[model samples]
Target: MENPPNPDPREALASAHRTFATEIEALRALDARLDDSFGRAVEMILGCRGRVVVTGIGKSGHIAKKIAATLASTGTPAFFMHGAEAIHGDLGMLTAQDIVLGISYSGAANELLTVLSVAKRMGTRLIAITGHPNSDLARNADLHLDAHVAHEACPLNLAPTASTTAALVLGDAIAVACLESRGFSREDFARSHPGGALGRKLLTRVRDIMRTGAALPVVRADTPIADALAEMSAKGMGMTIVVDDARRPVGIFTDGDLRRLIARHGDIRPLTVAAGMTHGPKSVAPGALAIEAAALMDSGRLSQMLVVDDGGLLLGALHMHDLLAAKVI
Candidate 1:
């Protein structure tokens, strides 16, 4: 059989608009419904002596997993337990000091009750994120967070849509509140995310990664261009810093400059490094973040740079490759 024609683009766009409008309204309603109960939930999680265990069935399970991850990443230690699996054997992961968070949009997921009851009996604290306050999950919970929405964005009103969005936003609110309450800083966040570009930006500094002292490709301003090129070749940084007699940086010469000079004339060995170098090239301090070094190199279209102290005296040297090797780029 042949397929029918697709709907009009205008209709498709209108459907998207409707869905966004419905979910946005759901979020506004949820915002109005917030009260001391929300604050109480944050307080319980903050004071937890053990990890927070989050669990749910179906769509709520996905939301619960995300909430658990956000909580764990933002300073609260948390992990998700599958609701159905918890009854089989996964409940051993929970302890008396733990807090169990169960999510149920209808407030009556059967798969969640068995494990919730077990956690309750073990003296573990229970928090419920539910759509119906009087549902079984809520009645059994120590604290209830209402995630009720007026309607689903789904045309059939059967699928989880606005309700899930509300639940997710509420989860984010809880995580951020917990993060602020615990005094979580960017540096602390870096420790948890040490493999990403953000970790390099926050944790890796110029001094830690820059080549210092003898490792620097350096020469005096009046040094022969051939000698400057030799220093760059020896250091393998593709560039050399030109300093005055006082050891203060006056310019920088790069392989690109060499190529330009060679392209213009063949016998360039007689030229002084001062004549071929870019005077007053930008430099960064040793204590700066390596990401800052990346910014300088990127904005100036440079491959290498000099590291100088506040007095403009050469302290070290670095190249864009250094930032790349450190993953700051």
Candidate 2:
């Protein structure tokens, strides 16, 4: 195949600018026209006891899929069902307890109309998002969200650009409203996205990443500095906890302390661990978030922090490398 001639860069840039302007105008119009129906839609979804089944066709179908994902991740139980597939056997996924949110730019797609019809017969409530308020889907719906745009962003005014953007933003508005109404929190979101970075930050506790048992470098306050150094090297944590008889952490000594001790006084072969250990070592509870521990370590310029119980009994130790290994930093 032969290569086509490149379009003029200025003309291409102008076309891009026009598209952005049209979409911005459409969103502004949508924001101004939004009214009580939006609140009503949120109320209906919140009152629902089951899932929200979002359905659409063609370009509207793409928007519907994203909206469903957004809703599901933000605390509203939802999933997308393609309009054509709903008629083919996917309709079994729908029930009277489910709410159907249908999207069609013209509100006249045969496949979407068919799905809405079956949804009505099943006694399922319907919410319609479309550019046509008087269209069949809107009229039959329990609530109608107007997604009408002045015109398409396409120069020919035939493509679905501005209208689809309007529909998508409207759906986001509804989902966010429901999310706030339900008191959805960051932890709730993290629970739904355990494999994502936010999940690691919010769901992972210090106990999950702290080194314990044989991994912890621990020593008695009166232990020889050579023994403390041996324990730190064996644990590979670059630090050792100086604990009392009750297993409560009272002080901490690090490689930095060792270097400072050497600089202050050469040949300290008789020094005890207590001679260089920092008193009142910082600590966090086992239940605290790894991210919180990371913050404390960062602000205090600490490489190690102790985990303890209410009675101050040391349970574990957190190294800076542990937070890095857990991807909490």
Candidate 3:
């Protein structure tokens, strides 16, 4: 009996490395080709009153969808259209105020050419991203962006490897340029992504999640420990907010503190909330994002925080669990 010889792992690793290096070199060459036409394409998209209609066929269509999503998420409204479908009936989705972005490696995709003609008839501005600037699609476009690469990353040199990567990068460049021209802020991005965790972090303020008014388990500094405990139990927040006579948060008393108080043989009826409370518990402004409050609670190892207004008046209270349920953390 005998064991088989092991394959050379080094050869496999070297082959992958070489492919990546070649593709990266292709991207570098594409970067060097960026010029005034790229700037003009961005300016045209920026001035578009309607959505940026991105159309391509096959592999380019997949890339166009991603590019359209990036553009929409970053404050530039955009959507992907299949070049073949545009000729069927989807061309009606476009308007004269819109800008059309056509993607083709050969700049001669028949489907794209058909839609390009419809776009022209509708008086829409056309921007072409292709490797061959002299090709039909590019020559007919109002602005032509040359995304030529020296060679494909594929050993066959026939697949849409380097060319697709170049197109994706060029689309990203256009999106970022439009974003800058429109002065799209982080707040603007947050507004468009309100259902995601990032939106919760940037847009969900403390007041939006805090338990306010009668829902807050609050006790005055002079309130007896037994009364405070009753309020905490009734509110089911595991803690009670301690406030001064002026309704400003002064301290906090939690269930853990109650255990310590009992261990000390304290008289619960005579002890005041101030006597058993941890002074100056972490607090946040009502206008602060809930995520910021969650960070403060996590970093400080606290379970809850009091929410206050500008003048230090108690607005409400927030718990770590509330943030978890809201997916704000």
Best TM-score among the predictions, by candidate number: 2
TM-score of each: 0.79, 0.95, 0.86
Each model's RMSD to truth, in Å? 4.3, 1.5, 3.8
Report the lDDT of model 2 for residue 24. Answer: 99
Residues 128-205 of candidate 2 have per-residue lDDT tens digits of: 998999999889888999999999998899989999999999889889999999999999999999888999999999
Candidate 1 stretches with Cα past 4 Å from truth are 2-5, 211-225, 234-236, 241-287, 294-303, 306-316, 324-329
**Collision count for each candidate, in order:** 0, 0, 0
Sort order, TM-score high to low: 2, 3, 1
Q: Candidate 3, residues 30-70: lDDT per residue as tens digits?
A: 88767888888888888889999998998888888889999
What are the lDDT scores of the predictions, listed in order?
Answer: 0.90, 0.93, 0.88
Q: How would you encode candidate 1's per-residue C-alpha lDDT over 192-278 as one tens digit per residue?
A: 888876787998989989999789888988898878888988999988888888999888888887888788778887888877788
Worst window of 10 by summed lDDT in candidate 3: 265-274
